[model samples]
Target: RLLNADDPFRKAYPSESPYFTDMGMNTTIKQVEKVDDQTVRFHLNNIDAAFIQNLAMSFASIQSAEYAAQLLKEGKAGDINQK
Candidate 1:
């Protein structure tokens, strides 16, 4: 699972800061069940309605996993960072 100090999706919305860093926080995701080949249930923590909206928007390039990984490896993902 990926863990980080900021919610990367926050860039899509207007915000003064990236995400709260006052104290360590986390959001966890687990594949609880698979509804179908294209769908799955995920368990999460510390998420909210805005986060859900961000998910629907498919944050970042919305490309396949492999391509996204390549962008991240090359440090080009920062180009999508709104902050």
Candidate 2:
């Protein structure tokens, strides 16, 4: 949910989130595009070293759109990362 502006997870960011900016998120990220099952694309407003490092953070995992859609269809989207 890193690119989700209104995601509740953003409000619960850890106090010591080093890769985060004073704005609470790396606003430098302009967009994220899923190229395929094995590839993705990130659009950035500028080159920020911290953004690169943010990829290594535990929460930076790539989510499966197909799985997300399945959850939505099943009315259990909130189960993401919980199970």
Task: Please list the residue runs of candidate 1 whose C-alpha ends up more than 4 Å from where it truly belongs after superposition.
Answer: 1-3, 6-37, 44-63, 81-83
Model 2 residue 52 CA deviation (Å) reads: 2.4
Clashing pairs in 2: none
**Top candidate when judged by TM-score against the true structure:** 2
Number of residue pairs clashing in candidate 1, backbone atoms closer than 3 angstroms, sequence gap of 3 or more or interchain = 0
Please state the error at residue 19 of candidate 2 in Å.
7.1
lDDT of 1 at 57: 40
Which parts of model 2 are misplaced by more than 4 Å? 5-26
| Stretch of 10 with least lDDT, candidate 2 | 8-17
Q: In terms of lDDT, which candidate is strongest?
A: 2
Q: Looking at candidate 1, what is the lDDT of residue 72?
A: 61
Among all windows of ten consecutive residues in candidate 1, which has the lowest summed lDDT? 16-25
